[model samples]
Each structure stands twice: as structure tokens, then as C-alpha cells.
Target: MSDIPPLRPLLIERPEDEGAETPATVPPVPDLDIAVPPPRLSRARNSALTRFAMWVFGALFSFVLSVAAWDFVTSLLARDSLLGWIAMVLVGLAIVTAVALAAREMAGFARMGRIDSLRTNAIEAALKADVKAARGVVSGLGALYSARPELAEAQVRLTARGAEMFDADGILGLAEQELLGPLDQAARREVEAAARQVATVTALVPLALADVATALYSNLRMIRRIAAIYGGRSGTLGSLRLMRGVFAHLAATGALAVGDDMIHSVAGGSVLSRISRRFGEGVVNGALTARVGVAAIDVCRPLPFRTLPRPKTSNLVSRALAGLFADADRNEKVK
Candidate 1:
């Protein structure tokens, strides 16, 4: 106190700092007055581009072929020369072939579209529990299930019952149980067999090319089998459409990833691994094929279960893998 002066609070405010405004702590404005728009219902548009391209190609090919045939026939009749005759014959043959091919493709597209529409209708009806709509669609699908007399009869009976039923759930459940249950069982068996075959091939075949060829052949066969089960017995064009639909469903539903993971897990290698042991690789391939088959069934089925739950993917994969490994063990024992 004696030696040093008592320090006063320093005046440190700069002129530039004077009157500086601070951000206000504003409370969030209540949004109670703002109305949220209802979510729009969007329709799934699967494979629209592919379908359009197919239609365009078919139309253009048919048009070009018709023009060529007309010109060739005109030349043949007007010129009466050997060259003209030969050209006419060749063009006629080509025209016939092209027309036939185009007709088949168009027919396939029509059939596939009809089936898809029918399926969509059935599912929506089932979900809504609309007994009348379900009955109508089921009855309309009689042509598809004609191959199975028992199933066809069941469909008729179910439709009649559905007409009288008040509960949509009961009607849908009954329809699925009586009509789709048998088909599902048969399809499952087919898929399991195919999976086993694929797995065995992957495990035993040393050559990558052979393995690929075998897998492709098995997958094609499996697709055909699943389509047949759904009463979609397709010709060449029909088969192609069915295969496309199956793949589209797999990709859309993320079943492709499940299949890939299963293959990797079972085979102990990636799906494209060339140096993997044939036996283990084959087993994995078979399991993957089986998953695809099951997914195809799900996609192709015309009915949905409102009361009954469908089998889960996990259950299917587990069963398929177990069956494959059990078969391997049995084979080893036999050896």
C-alpha cells in the first residue's frame, strides 16, 4: 500500500466494440399452424423400360419383315427369272421365320403382362380383404391352373365360399391354403433339388467353365420348374419372360444379396472364385440357386396370405444349407 498505488479497474472497451449487437436467443417458432401434406401413394413401375424396348423391337422387326416380303414377292412375280425365284424363296422363308418369331414374342409379352396384372390384383384384393374381388380374380385364373384338376376344383369351391364369406381374411386364408399351398410345396421341393444339384456340381467340378455351364443349366431348369408350378408353362419366348421376371423380382427384393452372402458363407469363397474347392463351391452354388427358386415362387404366386404368414428367408436358407450338407455327408458315407 505504501509502495504501490491501488490499481483501478482498467477501462478496456474499444470504440469499435461499443454498440456491438449480440445474436438474440430466439425460441423456436411453434409449427402447430403448419399443415403437413399427406404422403402420396406411388405405384411400383418395375421393368417399364425393358417391356417398352421389347415391344418396340417386336413392332419394328415385324414392320421391316413385312416390307421386305412384299418387295421380294413383287420382284419374283414381275421378273420371272431364276435369280428372282431364288431370292423370293429365301425372302419368303425369312419372312415366315421372322413373323413366327415376332408373333411368339408378342404373345409371350401379352401372357406375361396378363399374369402379372392378375397377380397384382389378387394380392391387392387379399390385402384389402375384399372377398368379392378375390373371388373374381381367382375364378378368372382358372385357365392357369387347368393342368391341376384338383387345384382347379379347389379354386372353384373357394371362389364360391369366398362369395358367401364376410371376413376377407378368412376367405384369403382359405384360398391360399387350398389353392397355393400345394403349389408352394411342389415348388419348394423343386428348388431344394436344384440347390442340391448346384451345390454338388460346384463341389465336384474342378473346371470353372464346366461349373458355370452346370450352374446356368441348373438355374434355367429351376426357373422352368417354378414357372410350371405356377401354371405358367411357357414356350421359348415365355421362358425368357419368366426368367426376366424372376431376376427382376430377386433384384428388387434384395434376395440377390442374400443369395450372394449365402454362397460366400457356404462355399468359403466369393461366387466368382475360380480356385475354390469344387465340392464346397458347388454346395454354396446350390444353396444360392435354391434361394433364387424360392424368390421366384414368391414373385409368381397369385395369392397373398392375409391370416397366414409365409416362410421367412432365414428359415429357407437354413433348411437349404442343412439339406446340402446332409447330402454331402451321406455321399461321403457311401464313398
Candidate 2:
């Protein structure tokens, strides 16, 4: 009894219901900053330098002519009459040869310039037509889809016409033919591949409608930036028109989730108003315009503009738009 009493005196205990939890500590997150290089100015400078060099060469020839003229006058005055006459004839002959050589070299260049101009015009025209056609198809499909959203069968059926219109081969038929068809094998393949992709992407009109709409917006913004850097020129009107046509088509199609009223409002704006925006910077800014201009000089140039390098870029939206009518005249493919 004495041993048990001694242990009982130490009993002091709390109530049973205490709840406690240790909180978890979180690690801090680090912010990452990535750096991208500035866009390439080399390509632009190269193009400008090349044109400047052509002008310089032309200027040098003029200088040579001036020197010859001065020499001819002095020789005539001194009149070792035979020597003067002989030197005069030789100078005339030399001038003629130089001119002939320059003309021969410049002919190809002139043709290239014209091709650039005409091809650009053709691209603008084709885009306008495609946009118009696309709008009609989109409007028709949108109306059908809106009224009968439940009818999946009807939706697919309605989209088929627009999709066909977007077909790559159908689009190719709109390009300048003679220039594109005779391209070397590798170049031809690249163009064909691009054409195929455009056609396939286009055939999914509803999806393309959204893509086109988004891309058009992005492209317009980007083009303006390029134009600011590149500055405006005559051919730039065509490029701006190309963008306008795409945006107009997308607006007309009612592709975005925006209300019908907004779509109609946008489409109501004058097409010309949209087209009058700025164009690109750099040396080859109107290069396509030059090429197309030359192509048009030929009567057999065909309906669609053709022959030219397809411009590729890290900027995908502008690149796609640029490529939209790229193969119109096949002749411009890089060899």
C-alpha cells in the first residue's frame, strides 16, 4: 500500500483533444530572361549595296565618257591630223563596245526588275480574288453553321466549297506559269512543297478562317513594323493590298467569335482604305515588283505571275502570307 501511494502523487495530465500540424515551406521561383538577336540587317544591306554598285558602275562609265570627250577635243586641236583622227575613231569604237556590253548585262537585270514588279501586282490581284472567294464561301458556311449548329453533317457539307477553293493546285493555277515550271529540280520541289502545304491548310477553311484572321492581324502589325524599317515605295501598295485582301476575306467570312455586327462593320470599310498602308524596308523591298514588271513585258507571261524566290522567315505569319501567292509564276524559284 505504501509503494502504490508514492507513484499516484505524480499524476498531472491534460485533456485528450489537441490538434496540431506542421506547415510546409515552399521554394522560391526564379524568373528567367531570354535574349534574342536582332533581325538580320545583312540581307537588306546586301541588296542595297548591290543596287548601289550597279548605279556606281553606270556612273563610272559616264566618267570614262567625259574623259574621252576631253581627250578627243585636245587631240583634234593638236592635229597630228592622222593620229588624232585614228584616236578619235578608236575612242568611238571603244565607247560603242562598252555601251553594247553594258546593255547586254543590264538586259537580264532589267528583265529581273520587271518580273519583280509584275509578280507583285499579280500577287496582290490573286490575294484579292482569293479573299473574295474565301469570303463568299465563309459567309455561306457561317450562315449555315449558325442556323444549324446542331447539324454536324450540314456544317461539314457547307465547308466543302470553301475548302476546295483553298486547294493548292487551284491556287497554283492562278500564278504566273512559264516562270515557275522550268525551275531546276530542287527549287521546284521546295515550291511544290510550299504550295501543297498552303492548299492543305486552306482546305480546312473554318480552321483556316481563324488562322487567317489571327495571322492577318499579326501580319498587318508586323508588316507595318517592317515598312517603317524598310519605308514605303510604289510596290508597297500591292503588298499592303495583299494584307488587306486577307483581312477583308476573314472579316467577310465571320471567322472570329466576334459579333456579326462587328464583322459587317469591318467589311464595310473601303477596300482602298485598307490597302493604302505602308510597305517594307531594306534593299530587296520591291524586288518582286521588279520581277513581275519584267514578266509582264512578255506577252506570253500567262495569267498568274510566276518565277521568284519564295521569301521564308522566322516570322511565320508574314512568311505564310508572303508565300500565299509565291508560285504564281514559276520562273522565280531559286536555282
Please tell me which predicted candidate would have the highest TM-score against the true structure: 1
Instruction: Show model 2 residue runs off by greater than 4 Å.
Output: 1-69, 72-79, 130-171, 174-179, 184-335
Over 1-335, each residue of candidate 2 has an lDDT whose tens digit, in order, gives 36564445567787764454335444443211111111211112358788999899989998997887868767685978777777777777987997776675454333333433433344454566655543443343244234432445444543454356564334434222212333222232332333234332432334525534533343444333332221111133334443443344334433222232321222222321332121111102222221221211121121232333332211222232334333321222442
Per-residue lDDT tens digits for candidate 1, residues 1-335, read 39888889988765685556656654643312111121111123559898899899989997997887778777787878787778888887876897788786666556556556666677678678787777667665766676677686787787687778776567667767777888888887778777767666666666658878877888888887776677655567667667776776666655554344554545334323543356555655665686578666765566644444555544554566665555555555576
Off-target runs (Cα >4 Å) in candidate 1 are: 1-94, 235-238, 258-276, 307-324, 330-335
Cα-based lDDT at residue 307, candidate 2: 35
**Who wins the lDDT comparison?**
1
* Poorest stretch of ten by lDDT in candidate 1: 33-42
> What is the lDDT for 99 in model 1?
78
